[model samples]
Target chain A: MIDEIIGLYNYWVVIFLMMTGFYVVIASTNLVKKIIGLNIFQTSVFILYITMGKVADGTAPILEEGITSYSNPLPHVLILTAIVVGVATTAVGLALVVRIKEAYDTIEEDEIHDQDDSL
Target chain B: MDNLAVIQVLLPLLSAPLCLLFNKARLAWMIAVVVSWAALFVSLSLLVMVNDNGPIIYEQGGWPAPIGIVYHVDILTAFVLLIVTSIAAVVMPYAGKSVEKEIPVSKQPAFFSALLLCMAGLLGIVSTGDAFNVFVFLEISSLATYALLSQGKDRRSLTSTFQYLIMGTIGGTFILIGIGLIYMKTGTLNMADLADRLPAVFDSRTVHASFAFLTVGICLKLALFPLHLWLPNAYTYAPSVVTIFVAATSTKVAVYMLLRFSFTVFGVDLVFAKLPLTEVLLPLAIVGILVGSLAAIKQSNIKRMLAYSSVAQIGYMILGISFVSASGLTGGILHLFNHAIIKAALFMALGAVAYQIGSTHIDALKGLAKKMPWTFAGFAIGGLSIIGVPLTAGFVSKWYLVLAAIEKEWWIVVAVLLVGSLLAVIYIWRVVEVAYFQTADDESDIQVKEAPLQLLIPLWILVIANIYFGINTSLTVESASSAATMLLGANS
Candidate 1:
């Protein structure tokens, strides 16, 4: 039971952080905070993918001598791309938040909603 | 074949930068028009190739799959390409005058560039057979869409864009997680390879979780029923031309993504016979249909009404899928293309209305029938199509849907389909009455002339297509039925 528990620790961490980020995104009212929460939620998946690529006693996937075992590198590449996507999303979100601040003078979701409703 | 499929996606990407370079609105518009129409031409030739030669697989960089990305061009790919590119082709020329009036001169270049990038992203998503590639292209389109929508003049659009970004990012991440899970199981991101390897692990819990994630993520992107909160405001506050383009293409591509994941990659039995997706999909579709139609009737803004109606129309497509038969899938797929044109025409007509009076509110449409008779006439025809009146393209799919429902002895679904059509008629007629019967208060001196020829031409073209496709159902019927059979054929 302890072995099983320790063996899958990464997955448990993944689920915990994923849920926490999701909750923060859902529970928070500030636009910037929501974005940060989203980034956290996204990074959890990066961990999930990286965990899948890991192998016991594996080294980086490179051809330099007689290393018999190598980690799977494809998931790492995919996460690299996904990380770029996350950054782009963050950049766009921040840019939009900046414009929202300019337009409404408030970055809180409730305040923005109230302004729109009043209109 | 001179590597046409890659060129179809690459053309738009290459052309987007050219728009930014031109810096002149007319020049940028011209570049957009030519590139979009060329993309359509590529789709046309591809459709012919796909029809005659069967599915063509082109490996990117001449490296075979499991190493390099590959594009698989089948009838389904061609059909989606036709819907997306044809709409872009029509909307691009229409954007010239419309963009000139709505956007500042300095922004027009970036506006066209982003539009082209969105088109490229959509084309890349549809054309590629790689699973991870879909997520990448999905983001490309989505980020551009946020930019396009935020360009709406209303400050409220900023809030709408922000909300859409949050929801859209979540959806994209869900899909990524789903893909990652499947990759963990299969060790390959090629869709065909995944499909081959997936059945071996169908009983795995991770695989099941992946399917659930994919469904919800795709549902969010397609704005399926309870997950569609971001659609109304996004459509309402978006600039008129932006609304026309995104409404016609983006959601339809998401629907195509749903079909690809459920049918091609996962197999029909896995989605329908083994799992209870139909149980979940059917009720949601029915509720979505009824609720969307009801909400549309209550909207004072015409654009928002059409946006709600689009939600209803998506329900119809999902309803067809829930039946889980070839004819049902055919009806659903046919609606994919038919709704693309129908909503594009209706939204284009509304764009013209907005251009003239600067408002899409019901009050602004008073006496439009006499003054902007051409625009109103187009709206009426498009409305009839949405209502599924006979001799319109909408009727063709509804007829097939009703037939499929009867085949299953699903009497309630049949009733729901008819009632949905009736609700469509009520909502459309509400607008018809306002546009035709109510006079633009005689004291006011607003001479509401017809929209510019650029706008009227595209609007009428789509209106006429609704009639033509309704009368001659051969193309939509043939492609949709074959696409359905191909999808189900994967099961056996």
Candidate 2:
């Protein structure tokens, strides 16, 4: 039973971080906070991918004279691409926040909703 | 011929950068029109090739399937490609004129570039057989869509785009996590290989969790019922041209993705039989149908009304899938095609109204039939199709859905389907009555001229397609059934 607990600890951490980030995105009203939450959420996913690629006693994926055991490199490569996508999403989300601030003069969701409702 | 699938995606992707090279708006518009038409022609040839020969698989870098990215063009891909490219082709002409009036002159060239990028991303999503590649193309389309949505004249569009950005990114991250979990278990990102290996781990809790994550994430992206909070505002406040393209293609491609994942990757026995996805999906779909149609009845803005109607139309598509029968899958796939043409035409007609009157408020459409007769005609025809009137494209798909429901002996679903259509009649009739019967409150507004030839021609093309495809089911019905069979048969 203890071994099972130890075996899946990485996934437990992943789930914890994911839910926390998701909660912040849902519960926070500040636009910047929400974007930060999104980044955190995406970052947790990156960790999940990277953790899954790790192999015990495995060396770097690069081939050497005697090394036959190496960690899987595919997930690392995939996560790199995902990180780029995350950055692009962050850039756009922040740009939209800037535009939203200009238009409504506030970045709070409740205030924006109130202002839009009045109009 | 194998390279044709690659060209379908590359044509628009290559043209987008070329669009940036043009300083003149007219040149940019010309480039967009020509390239979109080329995409249409390429997709048409692909459809014919797939219809005659079978699925076309193009391996990138000439590497084998397990190691290299592959573009897989089966009947399903070809059908969706036809819908996406045809909408792009028809929307481009209208976009040139619409952007001139709605966007600043200096922003026009960049607008076309973004539009082509959005198209290429959507095309990429539908064609690729690689799971990780789907995420790459999904973000490409999504980021471009955010830019397009923010271009609306209303300041509210900025907020709407932000809301979509937040929701879309979360959904995307969830999808990535799901793919990650699946990869952890199976160690392959190739979809067919994943399918081959998945049944071995079908009972794993992680696999189930991955399925749950993927379904919810995609539902959020496609705006399914409870997850649909972002769609109405995104459609309502977007520039009319953007609404015309995204409304018709984006969510439908998400539906295609859902179908692809459930049937192609996870297999039918696992998704439909072992899991209670149908039990969950059926209730949500039925509620979505009634709630969407009922909510649409309350909207005063025509654009928001149609946006709600889109939610209900998507409900019908999901309801068909929930039945898990050959006829049901056929109905769902058919609705994907039918709804694309119908909604695009209706939204384009609304764009025409907005261009002339500067608003899509139902009141603004009063006596519009007298002034913009052709546009109203397009609206009327498209609206009838939405109501599932006989001899229209909508009827064909709804007929299959009702038949599938009867096959399952599900009486409540049949009743819900009928009630949804009845509500569609109410909402559409409200517009028809306002446009045709009531006199304009301001007499001077009635003197507004017809929409430009560019807009009218595309609008009529889709309006005519709505009628043509309704009568001639040879293409749509055959492709949908063949695709459905392939999906179900692949798993067994």
Candidate 2 TM-score over all chains jointly: 0.98
User: Per-residue lDDT of A26-55 in model 1, one digit per residue for the tens?
Assistant: 999999999999999999999999999998
Task: Report residue B2 deviation for candidate 2 (angstroms).
Answer: 0.4
Evaluated at residue B79, the lDDT of candidate 1 is: 97
Docking class of 2: medium
Query: What level of docking quality does candidate 1 show?
Result: medium
lDDT of each: 0.93, 0.93
For all candidates, state DockQ relative to the true structure: 0.75, 0.74
TM-score of chain A of 1: 0.93
What is the DockQ (computed on Cα atoms) for candidate 2? 0.74
* Interface quality of candidate 1 as DockQ: 0.75
Cα lDDT of model 2 by residue, B136-210, tens digit? 999999999999999999999998888899899988887898898899899999999999999999999999999
Per-residue lDDT of model 1, residues B1-492, tens digit only? 838899999999998999898788778899999999999999999999999999878899998988789998899999999999999999999999888668999999999999999999999999999999999999999999999999998998888888899999999999999999999999999999989999999999999999999999999999999998999999999989999999999999999999999999999888788889999999999999999999999999999999999999999999988888999999999999999999999999999998988999998788788889999999999999999999999999999999999999999999999999999999999999988998887736766688899999999999999999999999989999999999889867
